[model samples]
Target: MKTLKSRPSAILFSCRARRGVLARGLNTTREIAMPEYLSPGVYVEEVDAGTQRIPGISTSIDRARWQSLVAEFKKTVVPQAPAWTDSNDTDPGVTLLELFAWLTENLLYRAHDIPERGRNAALRAATALSVLGHRCTTECATLTRAHFFAGQLLDAATLQAEQDYHREKLRRHNRMLHGFGIVSGLGVHVEATSDPGGGRVIVDPGYAIDRCGEEIAVCTGATLAFPSVGNEAFVSLRFWEHPCPPDSPSASGEPDVTRVEEACVIGFAQAVSPPALALARLIRADGGWRVDPAFVPPRAGAVMA
Candidate 1:
């Protein structure tokens, strides 16, 4: 079974990347327990393409600026020491710490030519602002829209809907956008099997409803993983994507997947951070704020590469 800390489509990126890993000493881990502490709420898995057990994969994504933003935001917003004694330590979401962390990350200053990762981070952070019920201003919306592919994809009706949703987020989102100069009103939809009996229910990405009616993207995490015959597993993970269902609202009370419905909300919360910071940092204006020291990674669960 191949081991990868990356999401399903993760690690499995490139065969050549794996060809060199065997020489990188990871080849031996295949014989033992899995690797540890890569990202919070995230974990690497060992996969096999039949004869080959423990095969690792590496792949290329849209190369959005969000990647850089996450790296930078992680380096800055997250903490070295636990925010509070007895913090979950594993998931790290005690208090509004994540919220403050979000604010702190948005305060970071970058260069004029934002990297793709940075662009993604900026967009994600803006999205978070909205989730926190922060509104988006014209400037903030424009700044965020500059790099947000989803926003650009909107038609006049959709655009108007988005703007209306922004206003609905407590106050007008434009205020948060302009006042804080950051992205706001980010929302995520988690869709469990509308019908769980379909064998392995496919919680298709961005397939759920966003009741907020905002232009929130969907970022998924491992709800349930299926073990393979070769002792390997196929875990599902979702990346940030366009909001097609603007008027859709997530089902209330419980997610269709009983186990998933019972799963902690932290799991879903953890999925947003990386994608959020990535989008925020992507198109954030340069030389705007003071740069803080890098934040240490979270202790467990959500693992990064």
Candidate 2:
């Protein structure tokens, strides 16, 4: 099926020690044992969306526009779509405003050039996809915020319309994609990632489906594989971590371990310093993702939960 709405997935929560300090023997020891790093610093491991910084004013404007988009979307768009589908719906339960807000935040305010202007064409060209998962802190602050938001800047109507347009497009084309696996030449905008062994993806409207043999792989908020079961396809998912930030250097000249978890530290090949573990955790949380600490950087700093 076409990519579905992102739902809650593997997530790590940041819970502070009630006392904030471990006593001599740490009397009240109760291992709640949530998904966490067996590393030095107390951290929660997760997969999350990446964030891009903009000017202060620009951020303010972007937030304002997002508010407007949500309002308009709740009024105009959301009313039309259902939350989900038995097979998948022509309309979505998520709002155009929400999608646009993400695009504004993550897409860095990029717009599509009417690649095909229709559902069929858009799907053929879209190799990547996204989904909407939740760990919504619902808090205004970005701290401990796990969600989908990573990209550049955006303008007024241009950004909203662009997001709105794709969201609607995703709604329109989802059913078709769910039925047939990958479709090339169908024009849809996706962010091509430099990840090895991952599909070249595009994220707008929150999802995309790629055909891999008998499996119809889905990409949106997370990556999943669906085995085509007769006329229908059953989905299996795999998530990817957002890339390490460009500016922040994690590896030292000789390769200093960034954020060490219970597992690995250096990329077997790159050794060029990946994202700091702290940063990686934040990104994963943004997407409400799951992490296998084995693949993460080795632990460093303080003991985590």
Per-structure clash totals for the candidates? 74, 51
Question: Which 10 residues in a row give candidate 2 its minimum summed lDDT?
Answer: 21-30
TM-score between candidate 1 and the true structure: 0.20
Q: What TM-score does candidate 2 get on C-alpha atoms?
A: 0.18
Model 2 score (lDDT): 0.24
Best by lDDT: 1
What are the RMSD figures for all models against the true structure?
22.5, 24.4
Error of 1 at 82 (Å): 20
How do all models score by TM-score? 0.20, 0.18
Report the C-alpha lDDT of model 1 over 43-111, residue by residue, as the tens digit: 343322222333343211222223333443453434543343344745646546877867655664333
Report the Cα lDDT for residue 17, model 1. Answer: 20
Candidate 2: stretches off by over 4 Å: 1-157, 177-305
